[model samples]
Target: MRADIDGLPVRELTGLEYASIVEGVSVDGEQSPIMHACGHDVHISALLGATRLLAEHRERWSGTFLALFQPAEERAGGARKMVDDGLDVRIPAPDVAFSQHVMATPAGNVHACLGPSFSTADSIKVTVFGRGGHGSMPHTTVDPAVLASMIVLRLQTVVSRETRPGEFAVVTVGKMTVGSKVNIISDRAELQLNVRTSTSTPGPAC
Candidate 1:
């Protein structure tokens, strides 16, 4: 069992009152707003429910259960950190590992996929360099925000123009960090991208 505790640094969009109340999350001393855009909260709740049920009704089950609580799925390092902390030596290795994800579906419906249910994902960070200057002066400064915007637009064509017609690919600029103040132009812009490569085939219908 695994749960990702980290949230994306995105503003809350839901008007519901049960939305995330956390103000900001700090990463490497820099603080930024965050929200649970991913379905990690559902995964964590499911894991907790399963654990409680198994514990409360031990007689209904027989085998040992190992609950692995993990964090930093956004950084993609939680499992690796656990392994590095000697997870193998801490307990007996299970016969198999199981992972479940929550997805939107019809009520009371459960769906599963054979082979790779999700595409291969990759994360990339790119910093667009520029020359910072006062906002009052336009021509003097090379705005990285402008550069970032152009790069992001160009990245959109990577899948459409480069990939084969039958194949599938994606490029997304998931996160971008630019100038802090409206009156100042930043010297650099940080960009985080999540790219997925499709792994589907034209299979026979049922």
Candidate 2:
């Protein structure tokens, strides 16, 4: 498998020491920036395991098998790049391609679905625009902090009260940052949201 242009940091998975070099001070704590909470390491490990299994059973299968350990899945365009890089032509195009994910579900139970099983996930960023003014004057500014709060709460309604019951929909404002400190009415605010789906309720079609 080819490597990513900017490969994922292995130190994110296995880091021995925290450095205090020229870059910046490294804080020591149980919580570290390099974490496998998203499970990318698990994915790579499983790919290796699958490769070993396929190698061991090489005699059983007759047709050619193309094993790809692709990258940039978080960006949602890695598979397309591999295809554009002649993945299907140089390697004999297989009749079907497959990928598997392990999620927080009922223990000891495995399940699979067909026809657009997972929903397309994407990130949404919203920047609330406002006017800045002195903290003493209450009505002088647009108060983007309040507007950002309204946006977050209103987005939730799009999923719960708006979307169809069977159709799965989610709009979440995961992070919000406004004023740096007290006594300052910030002029702008930013929010980041992560959205997800299943075959029972597919997102808008491309």
Candidate 3:
């Protein structure tokens, strides 16, 4: 068995005092605050529980068990690192292994089954460009606020309307910032989008 001891690079906005006290992540020369937004803590806790229970009941079973707690799952490959570090020789190579996860749901329940449950994560940062001018002048400049709104709306249809039914995919526009003041027309807008999917879909045309 294996559990991921990793977290995502997200700002902790829970308003709780015990939130992430550390700074964010640095990727490709960019930095952002980080948190355990992906429920990796719960996974690690479960792994500890299982290890303790089995250790206390060693007389009940005759089979071998291997528990692997790994880090850097959010990056490229943590498992490969484990293997290269002599995991196979340090522990008995078992025939099968399993892992579980906790996802955000209304019920807040835990479920487990065969097959794939998690999706690949792909994120992008985009800066929408437009012309800036006075707010009172309607025809003098291109309004990026309106254009950005349209782009956000159209991104929703990428998974819902274009992708085939029963396919697993999600496109989320998590952040957007535009304009400076009420009377100033902003020239640009910034957006952060995260994608999870098993297939690709068409993007909106600007």
lDDT: which candidate is best?
1
Question: Which one wins by lDDT: 1 or 2?
Answer: 1
Q: 1-206 in candidate 1: lDDT tens per residue?
A: 66776677767768789887676646756576777768877777778988999999999889878777778877888878988999879979778877666768875688897766667788999999999999999699999999999999999998888767756677889889999999999999999999988754433444
Q: Estimate TM-scores for all models.
A: 0.80, 0.68, 0.58
lDDT of 3 by residue, 72-155 (tens): 886647888988999879987567755456766565576765777778888788898999999999589998888889999999
Q: Which ten residues in a row have the lowest lDDT in candidate 2?
A: 19-28
| Candidate 2 RMSD to the real structure | 6.7
Best by TM-score: 1
Q: Clash pairs of candidate 3?
A: 24-33
State how far residue 144 of model 1 sits from its true place (Å): 2.4
Stretches off by above 4 angstroms in model 1 are 10-19, 28-37, 135-137, 181-183, 199-206
lDDT of 2 by residue, 120-197 (tens): 677887899998776888598998999999988888887788676667766667679899768778899999898764
lDDT on C-alpha atoms for all candidate structures: 0.82, 0.67, 0.80
